[model samples]
Target: MALSRQNQSFRIPCQQCPLREITHLRDFTADELEFVSRFKKGELVVEAGSTILVEGAHSAHLFTMLSGWAFRYKTLEDGRRQILNYLMPGDLVGLQGSIMGEMQHSVEALSPVILCVFERERLLTLYNLHPSLAFDITWIAAQEERILDEHLLSIGRRNALERAAYLIAFIFERGRRLELFDERRFIPLTQQHIADTLGLSIVHTNKTLKKLSSKGLLRWQERGCEILDPEGLLEVAGWTGLGEGKRPFV
Candidate 1:
């Protein structure tokens, strides 16, 4: 359960952001930081299983993930869902909402999340005035597109075992980018999450995961899965992952 929820008007200096201290994230200039600091609205504590951004809704704010996990997904008319991508701590959410005036995909918190909110209207100001910050925004969106491309390839072409392996390795690498890597850390995901993500039935997902486990690639427990050999998973998947970049976190 969520411990508590707080909503307010607050300012967080960009230079002082927690994510900035951890990853090879881009550092903001004084002017840029000031602009972003003023842009910040407040922090939101979102509970796990709560929807953060709803599809087709007009959202006035964009959020930067301060902590915890979320996933972007879309559901069809018959309620068939496709998990698009996992959102890590440093990931930005609601870019589509900010740009298009309505959300195309929904975001749900997988773990209790802390988000840094910023007004959507000021985005054009940053783009028009701060060239570097504008590039960073473009980079962030490009990265998200790249992830979706990978998912499309996996779901469309990869076999069941390879698809499962690819998803684990891909999410783990992303977690590493967020500086959330720890050998002993358990990925807070259930088999059903994997099933939905890979477009597999729950039983098929379990069988695929067991195959990965028996091969010493991962250990899947009741509550979470632990990555044992990422390289092994990469080999199994026959898919190489994305290269790291200096990304912006705000």
Candidate 2:
């Protein structure tokens, strides 16, 4: 759970942020950009498997993912975990903690990650002075709710194979939009991760994955999952798509 905070000198200026170039995110106005530059505290580098935010704790800072991947999850008293959602570059972290005063779920890094830190206390300034940015934050929250709604439907109603296909397809589409997949088209996830997310046993998850692989929908690798035919997966899951349009992030 230990995080490595970089020296303030290492902070990436908001104007030079690589995420701003992403076509899926809205462009920031000059004033907004300047305010964000001043608002950023520094950078934090966390290794894979590190817990970035612990449930029930009040965090002093918020973060924006600059690189790598992470997931939000909650565990029961007996340690059964349910993954809520996955996060990628430009995704905001700890907003709930900032607004609600405590984190309801924990966040863990799936790979080495870089996060832009922002002081929680300064959030009011942004809301008061920049209504547009505040709306963007609201949009981001609504977007998370929308994704959760889809996951709830999958877990509550979809069959085992359908749920697996839906989850994989969901991740693939989001990553594709962010240009995260490389030539390998690999998704950095283990069977256990999939099982937890889908509310299935590890054995059942493995079998379901095998079924998908046999149908040329995806392949399971030692390191992760490889997407072969996203379109076929969508058809199997009976999902339309993530819906059209660029998404906003803070």
Which candidate gets the maximum TM-score versus the true structure? 2
Candidate models: Cα lDDT each = 0.85, 0.92
| Per-residue lDDT of model 1, residues 1-250, tens digit only | 1343657755455667887677567778889888888888888889989889889999788899988998999999999888888998878899998988899999999988988888898898888988888888888898788878888999999999999999998888778777786768578899989999999999999999999999999989876799988889999999777576777766
Off by over 4 Å in 1: 1-6, 9-12
lDDT of 1 at 9: 50
What are the RMSDs of all candidates, in order? 2.1, 1.0
lDDT tens digits by residue: candidate 2, 15-94: 89998898877879889888988899999999888999999999999999999999999999999999999999989999
TM-score of each prediction: 0.93, 0.98
After superposition, which runs of candidate 2 have C-alpha atoms over 4 Å from their true positions? none
TM-score of 1: 0.93
TM-score of 2: 0.98
